[model samples]
Target chain A: MDEVSRKTFLLFGDSLTQRSFDEGGWGGRLASAYQRKADVIARGYSGYNTRWAAYTLEKIFTKGHVPPDLVTIFFGANDAALPDRLNGRQHVPIEEYVAHLRAFVEHIRSVGTKHIILITPPPVDETVRVQENQQKVGGEQEAAMLPERTNAVAGEYAKAVKQLGEELGIPVVDLWSNIQMQPLWQACLSDGLHFTSTGNAAVYHLVQAKINEALPHLRPDALSMDFPGHADIDASSPDSAFKGTAIS
Target chain B: MDEVSRKTFLLFGDSLTQRSFDEGGWGGRLASAYQRKADVIARGYSGYNTRWAAYTLEKIFTKGHVPPDLVTIFFGANDAALPDRLNGRQHVPIEEYVAHLRAFVEHIRSVGTKHIILITPPPVDETVRVQENQQKVGGEQEAAMLPERTNAVAGEYAKAVKQLGEELGIPVVDLWSNIQMQPLWQACLSDGLHFTSTGNAAVYHLVQAKINEALPHLRPDALSMDFPGHADIDASSPDSAFKGTAIS
Candidate 1:
C-alpha cells in the first residue's frame, strides 16, 4: 500500500464481484473513475457464501499492513440458496448469514477501515435462472432446480442487509430493491444471476452515486488527474514538471 | 508486496496502457484471466512519450519495495509522431526512443524484475487518424496534421523495440506488424491511435501467447488457484479448510 501511496478501495464479494471487471462491469468502471484517485482491488470469490467469506477474511486482509480506505462486502447470493437443494454446499440459514456479515463488518472496521458498504444480493429471476441452470447442470435434476433460489427468498436477505446497514450505521446499496424498480430490470441480469453489460452499467451508476454521497472526496473530480496536462510538462526538467502533481 | 503475497504483473506504458481497463480492454481482461494467480497493475502515463516515462521511472518503481515479478514496457505510439508535426509535444526521435527503452529495461532488471516484455506500438492508420484528428482539433490546420503519425514511421520504432528485445534477451510483442496483417486491421483501432475492443482482444491474445511461450509457469493453468474447494472444508474447524492451500 505504501509502495503505491494511493488510497485503496477493496471490494470483497462473491462471483458478481469476481466478474466485476467484465466488459463494462462495475469494478472496471470504478477503477476508471478512480484512475488517479485510488486503487480499486477486487477480492471476489465465486461460488462463495458468507461462511467461507468469514473464514477467508483474515487470510486476505490483515491489519495495518495494507488497510483499505473503503471496503464493500457483497454476498448472500449463494448464501440465500434453498436448504433442501442438492447443492447445499453454499447455503447458509438467514440467522447465520446475518451473523457472518456482522462479523465480517466488525473485523473490517477493527482493521481501521473508515468507510464500509454492504450491498444486498440483487433480485433473482427464477424462470431465466432455471433455464440456465438446466443447461449448466443438465439432465432430469435440472428441472427439479425450480426454486433453488427465488427472488422472494433473496428479498429477505436484501431486507436483512438493509437492516444490518442501519444497525451498523454504514452505507448500504439496495441493489435488489433499486434494480427491480427499473422498468427493464430483467435486462440487468444476464442469466437471472450474473449481470449483463446493462446490469453492470446500472450498478456502476448506483455505486457512483453512493460514493458521491458518502465519500465525496474520493470522487473523480476531487482527485488529481494523471501526469498534469501534457502541455504543462516542462521539457527540460520532466521530473519536476509532475513533482507535486504526480500520483507518487 | 508481502501483504497480498500474490504475483504482480506491472504494466508500464503510455495512454494505451492507461486505458487498458476500458470496456473490454486488455488489462482488465488479463486481470480476470489471472484472477487468484497474479495481479495486473497499470502504471500508465497518458500522452507521455518514452522520454517522460524515463524521467518518472524511479518515482513509480522504487527499489526493493513491491518489486514487480513481470514488467511490461509499452510506448512508441506518442514517440513515433513525425518530428516536424504540430503535436511535437509527444514526439521522440527514433534514436532517443530506442535508447530510452534500453534504459527502462536495464533499470527494471536492476530492480529484480524477473520477466520483462517490450510491446511495440500498434501501427497507426493514417487515413482514420486524419479524420479523427480533424474532428477532435478542428479547423484548417487539421489538414496539415497530415503525417502526424504514419504506419511506416511507427514500424521503425517497432523494429527498434524488437531489436532491443534481442539485445536485452527479453520477449517482444510485435503488435504493429501482426495487427495490420489481420484482415480489416483498421477496425482494430477505435480512433486510429487507440484500440477498440477487437484490437484489445487481439493484443491480449498475442500477449497471452507470448507469456505462455516465455513464462509458461505464469499462465493461469500453471499457477495454483486461490483457496481450496469448498466441499473439502471441515465444518467444525473452518481454519483447517485451507491449511496448506490458502493464498498465504
Candidate 2:
C-alpha cells in the first residue's frame, strides 16, 4: 500500500480541535455520529498557534495531499495559550489571528474545499488548579475550575470563527458556549491540555450539533415509537435523550 | 445547514496517523484524495491508547457512527509512550496494547469496515526531544522505535491484525518497516511524539498505497490512464508522477 486515496476532510486547528477524545474527543464523536460510507480525516495538533497552523497547511498540500472538500478549523486556544505556549505571556492579537485563519481558509478553498466549518475552541480555565504545581498566567494562583477562564478564549475564538465564517462564507460552530454550558466539561479534561474520556463524549455531542447545524436535513428527526415519554400503550421508555419541543 | 449528512471514513489513531502533511492532516489529505466524494468523519486524537481506543468504539457505535467501508487505524505510539498518556506515566504493556488493538480491529470489522488497515506507527527517533523528554525504564521506549523492540509488539499487533485478517481475513498494511525505509520519515516529525509536516506527507503516500493495495484494479497499472492524475499527454510521454512505475 503506497498511495492513500480516500476522499479526505482535513481538520485544521489547535489542541481543542486536535486533541483526540480517543475514549472521547468531539471529533471522535462526530466521526461516530457521521460515520456512514464517509471519510472524515482529522489533522489538528495541540498547543499550537495560527502561525504554525499556516505553515503546517502548506507542507500538507504542496507535498501531494491536496484538494479537500471540507476543512473544519478551530484554532486560537494555544495561540491564546498562557505564556509558556505563547511567547512569554504575549497573546496573539485577534486581528493577526484572523489574518492567519483567512490565509488558511483561502488556501483550503483554493485547493477546492468550498465547504468548511471554522470552529472556536472551548474556553480556558485560568484557575483550573491554583496549586504551585498547576499554575499558568498572570492571574493570582487560585483554585478555579478550567471552565472559568478558558471559555473566555473559547468565546473570543468562537466569535472570531463566526466573523471568519461571515467573511469567508464557511459555516461556523461555536463550541465555546456549548462546551461551557456543560457542567461536566471541567471533569473530562485529560490534563489541562486534552480531554479526559468523558470530555470527548461531551465534545462529540457539541460537534454533532454543529455538523447537524450544517446539514440538518441529513438528520431526519428520529421518531419515537409510542412517543416513548408519553404514558401510552406498551410503556418501555428508556430516557429519551431528545427533549421534545413540539414542532409548531 | 443543519446536518453533515455526508459519506464518512472514521480515522482512529495517534499523531502520524492523524497529523496533516502540510495544509491538512492525512484526514484532510484523505478527503482531498477522494475528491470530496466521501465525507470522512475523523476520530483522531493525539496520545490515546488501545484501552481508550477499545472503550470508545462501543460508545461511538451505540451512538450510531459505525458502519463504514473503511476504518483506517494506526495507533500504539501513544500506547508506547514512554511516560504514557492514558493515566499519565501509566505505561502500556505490549500485551495490553495488543489486546486493545485486536479489540479495536474486531470492532471496526464488526461495524463493517471491510477495508480496514491496521497500520503500525512509524519508528520513533530515540534521539528526538520529546522522546528524550519521555525517556523511560527498560528498552520499551527505545524499543518502540526499533524494529526488534516494538517489532515484537508490532509483530504481535500486526500478527493480531493478520490473524484477525486471516480469521476475519482482512488486509493489514505493514507501515512499521515500510515507513522506516522511507527517506524522509525522520525529517517529518517535530518531536518524538508525532509526525511533522513533511513526515505526514510520506504517511499520506503510504496510506495511498494501502488503498491501492486494497483496490489494485483502481491503480493506473491496472487500467490505462483514465483517472484524476491523468493529463492531456502526447501518449508518448506519460504522466511523470507515474513515470517508470506504470504508465509507460
Among these predicted structures, which one has the highest DockQ?
1
Q: Estimate each model's TM-score.
A: 0.94, 0.43
lDDT of 2 by residue, A58-162 (tens): 544442334655667778765554443323232456777788888877766656665777777665554443321244444443432222234556467668878
Model 2 ranges off by over 4 Å = A1-7, A62-66, A82-90, A132-154, A216-248, B1-248
Highest lDDT: give the candidate number: 1
Worst 10 residues of 1 chain B by lDDT: B239-248
lDDT of 1: 0.82
Docking class of 2: incorrect
Segments of candidate 1 deviating more than 4 angstroms: A1-4, A136-139, A142-145, A236-239, A244-248, B1-5, B142-145, B231-239, B244-248
Across the candidates, what are chain A's individual TM-scores? 0.91, 0.69
Task: Give lDDT tens digits, candidate 1, residues B1-248.
Answer: 11444788888999898888888889888888887667777888788898877766775677766678898899999999877765777888899899888888877777778898899999998988787667767847754568579999999999999999998899999999999999999999998889999999999898999999999988878987667556667645666876633221
Q: What is the lDDT of residue B31 in candidate 2?
A: 51
- Model 1 pairs in collision: none
Model 2 chain A scores worst on lDDT over the 10 consecutive residues at: A226-235
